[model samples]
Target: MGTFEGLVAFSVTPTRPDESIDEDRLCAHIDTLIAAGVDGIAIFGSTGSIGSFSEAERRRVAEVTTKHVGRRVPVAIGTGAMTTAEAVRLSEHAEKVGADALLVVPITYWPLNEAELCAHYRAIASATQLPIFAYNSPVLTGVDMTPNIIVRLWQDGRVKYLKESARDLLRIPQVKEATEGRLRIFGGRDDSIVEALRLGADGWTSGAANIVPRACRRLFNFANDSQNEFAAHILQRRLAPLMSFLMDKGHVSVCHTALEILGRPIGTPRRPILPLAGEDRIHLEGILRSLEEEL
Candidate 1:
């Protein structure tokens, strides 16, 4: 298994109002992240709106992101599906397309027990040579992979990382202690990146990086340097507002709107998931524009 190290961005796909992936703009978004000096780029992640996309669309995203990233940085793809077989298929395609790793979320629809969840990851790990990071976003997935289960998977040597999105910041230490620091922990909570790192997380998978890559990297760097107070200030002044909109308003909408304000052409979010409207849009655009000015 490859070591999961460094600051990574779970990039949002730039799309049109109709929700089609804007290929050129998407490439530009990748360039934005690379230019910001991020360690890696994770496309089609939860913040990237991967669940709304089809397998073919996700594969295309991975291919494009990998091509643009080249060898400058590692590229991780989110290949989690509702079924083990589908996840394996997506992961195999990612490996074939030269992705560096796979961020696998648990199957969301039919919640599985710890044993079933373990088997799902084991199956995917067995299918591909790429490193696997188990994503535990219980808030979204409706299932939580406890520390014991996480330790078990890590001991198997197939699961290399954990995207801890449980909102329980304290769990970082627990997982680290349980695994003896062997399992790399990544912060999936945008509002608590530095807190997680302070608690022994190796790095972070930031959704805010989609619009504020440099700031995210700066926050991570500052925290790594033990400048907790300074980083927390920045998070409060800048990252926190954007994260609130994403968390309270809508993730994809805020991301798309932020991209627009930044002069990128990531289109509106897909259907069934509506675009930002009313005061939410005004507030999002205002915050983004203010942030752009500051940057």
Candidate 2:
């Protein structure tokens, strides 16, 4: 169930109006992703608003998603939390629920040091047999996983893969060199997929794929499978507007708007993160329509 590679979409957890997880909508959304041919389905990611959920809600989402997916595709569950103990608990619960892999980010307000980061990972690794995908999103997690540290985690056999999201293309090659090809790197942002692959990323962990799965898969195949540089570049260009908005606007909000525009309403985003509105919404729709035609 480990050693996974390819386009893995960070799914947006569909909720009811009251912000409770809508299991029926969530399951249906996953079914669409599997049918669209994503290599894996990741639940409780930033796109899924993992941190916004309570511990109980997170566990429930993991169980329901794993059961509904039913081994159709690899399911990577995000088990990051504010504290080491919470992270371990989430990781253990994820393992107990039959998840194929776990995405762990150093999700704490207090910045973590090199030793603390390693220890946090080691603790979670001890709790689960699932492959660990260390998520390096300094923007969100406040901890940049440097090459040396990433290598150390791999050396300890605690981290099996990396989701590099620093948005610096150079980090791709840096990670490749640091890990000596032992760690498989996945691009975390959609806009950077082509360059990431060109620089040796194994695959992409894209949130945009939730709305445009076919295009994401095509872009990956063109770059990695077909090795068609020209086609890959062209497809990435077509997806750039949506990617740009996602980067400019919040990924979750922009994606939610796109999904609703496409006739798949998953209710409003959880409180404190209102749905997109007005001019930004109009502009996002324009981009979405242009993208739809290209697809």
Candidate 3:
């Protein structure tokens, strides 16, 4: 399909008070992002808590999101699973439901070597024709798919893009160099967007975009505009506090909490991943308020 670029908001699978996937809330949330002019939307990602949902629920989310999005912008479904069989199944489902791309992360109960990782991607890619955006999230997945490994995967023509979330800016150019500018690299952390742009990243994938889509888009536009470096720097400085808060606390929980305070209220995160509370929530409110003044 088409290449994915620009500000792609990493969605939170909005839940009801009972922790069920609230389809109405999810659709409304995506509509908000689309109205804000996001380039794309990624569901069932780490920020969306893909691991928290069952396979059936993931598929339902994919179906609802693709149905709701309806060619407005590309939809990238996270189809990563603990095993190749599950990943293939999810990837096939994503393709069948009209998803534009697949974001596959290496999920392992134990460590995976380079060969095993390669095999994992190869098998999944064979199962679906949708472009694959390999995810490099070592924190949750415990497998840091390196730039070289990613380059190899890209060479095989399966992986078209990479969502690098390791907080290592070096990987941005490293992946580019390894692949000889073949792989589209996206910044994974909100706080790292500026640096990523400076290093020639194609776009950014952010959980915080759920709360501040307009601001995030403006910042990315400024950064990407080349001649507007001065303006981008000013905007980045103004947005730093909120970005810092998101990176410091936790993007998932903070966005969930911030959404509620803004009155959009996507509902609480699922159990075992509690919503932000107490002083942290208060601090987030203050940061968000100040961010509005910057915009």
Candidate 4:
């Protein structure tokens, strides 16, 4: 169940105008990723606006995605919440609803201590049999999961994988060496995928994949082979401009705009996070236009 590898595209939770999940559009959107040959599908990750939705909506998204996809590819659900109890409930729910794996982040309103962090994950480990990814996204979550913490979690057998998004490439090999290569790793940063692959990442949990899944997979395949590294790097350069944008701007807003550009509009970002507008929208349009041949 923990066998996540090679371009695990994060699905955008497309909502209707009323902000309920647009089930049909979400299905069609995921159909796009599957057709593009993405090795796995992840829902309700940061790209899915995990923090914005309620527990019920998150469950519905997980249930609907797993039910609709139905053994086509692995589906990983993000079970991160502000508290341990909420996270545990979501983890149990993900496993119950047939999620192939679980992605967990130490979400905290106040920054969590190392001990608090360990306890949070340990409780979740006790609650579910699903393989767990201890997600490390310092930018979004405001907490850095050091290699020491990940190593300790690995030692305790609490987390099965690390979805690393903290942009420091050295942490990949650091975690690998500390865990003796046991804790599987998925790279989450858009800009550093090539280096992450070279650093022995198992795969990438990508926001850009919501826009160009095929390119992400192609980059994964090509970069893995020394013979194809040159071609892969060349493609990565073409993709770099937009990749930079997705990171600089938020994933949800940029992806929503890019999808609309591709003539497949997924609704707006939930409020408190605004839609792409003015120069940002125009800039994104230019970026998409430049990549027509690649797309």
Task: Tell me the TM-score of each prediction against the true structure.
Answer: 0.94, 0.97, 0.97, 0.98
lDDT per residue for candidate 2 within 145-223, as digits (tens), equals 8888888899988687899999688988987987888788999987878888888998899999888998888888998
Best by TM-score: 4
lDDT of 2: 0.87
**Residues 63-145, model 1: lDDT tens digits:** 88888778778888999998888899999999998888899988577779989998889999999898888899888889999
Sequence-dependent TM-score of model 1: 0.94
Q: Model-by-model lDDT, in order?
A: 0.82, 0.87, 0.88, 0.89
How good is model 3 by TM-score? 0.97
Q: Model 4 residue 52 lDDT?
A: 89
Clash pairs of candidate 2? Answer: none
Model 3: worst 10 consecutive residues (lDDT sum): 286-295
Off by over 4 Å in 4: none
lDDT (C-alpha) at residue 43 in model 4: 90
Model 3 residue 177 CA deviation (Å) reads 1.8
Flag the better candidate by lDDT, 1 or 2: 2
> How do these models rank on lDDT, best leading?
4, 3, 2, 1
TM-score of 4: 0.98
On lDDT, the leading prediction is: 4
